[model samples]
Target: MTEQIPVQPVRQVHLLLVDDHPLVRDGLRARLETIASIRIAGEAGTAEEALAIAASAPVDLILMDINLGTGNGISLTARFKTEYPHIAVIMLSMHEKTEYVNQSIQAGARAYVLKDAPAVEIIEAIDTVIAGGTYFSSGLNRQTASSDAGQLLTQREQSILKCIATGKSNKHIARELGLSVRTVETHRLNIKRKLNIEGQADLIRYALSNVIV
Candidate 1:
């Protein structure tokens, strides 16, 4: 038999944490340090520091806060993306306001994650965005589920939402769509969260009401 080549990860992602609060940065650094495929290249407490670090280091992605003291995170995102289109950014904030979400997208951020989100969701957002996919924190307005709301959900997410509307079980969805059960569950949860629906019944109602038939 021929020798099989080993697979590679998303290029040993290098991340720059940009938050004004030192405690927040320390907490995020501690949590992110556990991931073997990612490196915390630098930490910044202001826009100037972030820009300086970005210029000097090999940063692949940046986790930017919405409020960075005198440096507005959204403004910084716009500037960074305009200057370095190759660098990806994820906005972190405590608010899930639709205005903020849309602003982030307009400013060139590929993902928006909530600061209070579980570590798993945070890691998931990082992984998704670095892989050239968009990720938004759950509990954002449902308008994002459609074109009118910045078309937040990925194509896969849209497909899974249809499956959910069809009343298919997660196991059935996995078998029909050739996805893992866990993957289906994750997508399902994300759908509910994105739609800001707390109950399965509400999720189905919203899906059906939105003509997701």
Candidate 2:
């Protein structure tokens, strides 16, 4: 009798690629498609198109551009989070400024990857986000500093902070804690005011440094 081999199931990630440039989207799709676990569900050439696709497609993750046709990608990210509430988004941009990262995070992006980041880094980011973790490029993580002065955070705020550190959006944290999305948003605002971190990116750093969830 011949011995039987067991076949492991494949975990597929339905990814949505959103960028203004066709070549960029195509290249990214091709690169990611080479991975057996990832599938490009659709591509959008503008923020509006991206949102439309998201509403109609079975997308699990979004690779979104920071600068769309004429709108800011951060705004789109915020809207996408509000509308879908389950889909994860990672910001893809050329700028690595803390402000951009901060805004993107606050807007509910799970990761921030520079357009020129190593291909391996991008792949790692997708894996991290898929695994319910957040990832920022190495350059941003290298900056180490802390400051004191802001509104005092409540315990719930602290809990939410910890969740953010783990790369969870408002929806995920809310679902895990059995809270509403609006309630999560309220807690997020309180965290920002209490930490005085300046923006979304700063909040991510603060959460990483002060809380563990």
Candidate 3:
């Protein structure tokens, strides 16, 4: 005689899609609905609607757009992390800009994925985040290598970087910081080396894009 055993079903992950565009929500629903382990809890076109749904319904994860066109997804993500610390959020953006990605991470998003990323990548992001890990778009991996450089900078270097972001000259930065122009230049070179940025314009752009806050 042989005994038969039944296999347990996979857990369903409740997902909420948040975007200002209805078409975007529809597209996301179409792509995510095909996954058997995922069950879409709801959809929202604005921060208010998302908050409402989350407050009243069961939502395990959120696929949120960085720019809602009418609201800010990063701010909403901060709010969500504050109120619903258990819910995981992933920011979706059209561009692979480090600025947006850094903001999203600060706001407590578990992952950042490009809007044009393949569905498989998105699915991978969901699985990874749900399984207690972080994920970023493959296209932005190289760009994000500089994202953590801010932490490696000294306070003086960061101040110089901020000044450069505002279009200040090295001489001006030195005068403002009560340091010699040569000292400022040394710090500037160190900043460039740490960030792996070669050109002055690129350094300025990076400084402007990555606000410490």
Candidate 4:
């Protein structure tokens, strides 16, 4: 009598979806569910929720967007890396800007992809990141000469950035840096113009990622 050999079960990639938009999550789930080797383990609309779910669930990869309300995706990615470094993260963002991409990378994301990219590319990014490789969307790997890379600042500006990362106000940073309020305001404006940070949150993310001080 001939004995039959048992086939080994292929491991499915467990994924956590983080996006504020319900449609986006549904669309992604539909597309990804079609792949036999992928499984949607969880979903989150905010970074805090994502972190909590990640802590409780078995996730192999996180498909995260960079614009989650309250907790931005970059900051969440950084926190996740700090708290749970074993899981891989692939940032699914509409941001094609060099600074945003740089921030995501600095925050420990394994991949970055624009939202408009083909579904196959997104899937490929997840696969690549899970395999211990880095991935970037096309035309996003290099910092251009006109890029935010040239956003230079003085020593004081660097110090102020460190302050900002700690959630300090202009007046508070001024007091800490031993500068006048007006001078601190000027430095803040310079930092904004130089770093191309559009909002206070962006400033914080940029500072946290740069950590020049």
Candidate 5:
């Protein structure tokens, strides 16, 4: 006599897609569905919708766009990590700027993939993030490495420099970035020390010349 055993199906990785574009979402859904162990748990065209779906459903990961209509994904990622620390997030963006990548990482994204990246790279990012690893697209890594500004400045410093380059006052930069004016002044002082700029004019000139947009 022989006993028969049933084999259990492998558990799929449930994912949430958050992007403002319906076509992008549809294309992502089709591509992700081809993978055997990945499943789309939900789709959201805005931050509000994404938050609502996450509260109701069991999502293992979120593939979020950098720009979600009027809402930004970097801020949303920080909120999600603060509220639901267990869920992982992978940022999908067209922007390959090191400042954006650094900000996303600081906000708790497990991976960053460019929108134009091949499907295989995106899949690799998903798998790596799911396995509790950090992943950045090869192009982004190369850009980060080749840019001396990226290597020198912290994310906040880069942001402040950008504001300065745009002729924003310390108070304005502080208000826009949600920091106190004193803190902005301190950052400016630090930036000057690091970059060896002796005066306001020099700082602004350096910022305008060095800051990436």
Candidate 6:
């Protein structure tokens, strides 16, 4: 005699799609819906709407676009991480610039994927992030490897470089980051030395060329 056992259903990973474009969200929903282990919990067109939805009904992962019309997705990612540290975030952007990728990671995004990437890559990113790992688009990794800039700068140095690129003074960066002016200056010097940048003009040029707008 043989005993029959009931099969248990696999749990689905609930996801929130945040993009300013309706078409983009719809396309993502269509692709993600095909995966048996993934579910679309909600869709938001702005950071505010996303936050509101998440506050009411939490999701396991968030697929967020970098540009959200009037809002910035990177800042939103930081906010989400600050408020809900458990949930993972994967950034979707058109830019493959190393600075953008690094900044997104610093902002608490578990993965940085390009919008034009194949659906399989996106799915792979989702799987990796859900499995407590980080992922970056293949193209982005290639670009980062070619430049060698991302490897040279620490996270704090990257932040300082971004500030410098945006025309912020040392005093402003110090105040904003809660660091002393001397500390900011030291970081600036270290950044220049690491990048082999000689002067303020060269530093700004390097920062402008490397950083994403």
User: Candidate 6: deviation at residue 101, Å?
Assistant: 0.5
Q: What clash pairs does model 4 have? A: none
The lDDT of each candidate is 0.81, 0.78, 0.85, 0.78, 0.84, 0.84
Candidate 6 residue-wise lDDT, 56-138, digit = tens: 98599999999999899999999999998888999999987767776787788878788999999999989978876566776
For residues 1-213, what per-residue lDDT tens digits would candidate 5 score against the true structure?
Answer: 788889889779999999999999999999999888998999999999999998999999999999987899999999999998989999999997778877787798877788999999999989877876566776565436224555445689889999999999999999999999999998887565434356899789877777767
Clash-forming residue pairs, model 6: none
Best by TM-score: 3
**Candidate 4 runs further than 4 Å off:** 1-3, 139-213
Q: TM per model?
A: 0.68, 0.68, 0.69, 0.65, 0.66, 0.68
Clashes of 4: 0
Which candidate number maximizes lDDT? 3
What's the lDDT for candidate 5? 0.84
lDDT of 1 by residue, 47-147 (tens): 99999998999999999999987979999999999888899999989867777777887789888888988888889988888766677777455564333
Which pairs of residues collide in model 1? none
RMSD, every candidate, angstroms: 6.7, 8.8, 11.2, 13.9, 12.7, 11.4
Model 4: per-residue lDDT, tens digit, 64-173? 99988766999999988999898888989888777777777678887778888899888878776676656666534334211453334556877887888778888898
Tell me the spans in candidate 5 whose CA falls farther than 4 Å from its real position: 1-6, 145-213
Lowest-sum lDDT 10-residue window in model 2: 142-151
Off by over 4 Å in 3: 151-213
Model 2 vs. true fold: TM = 0.68
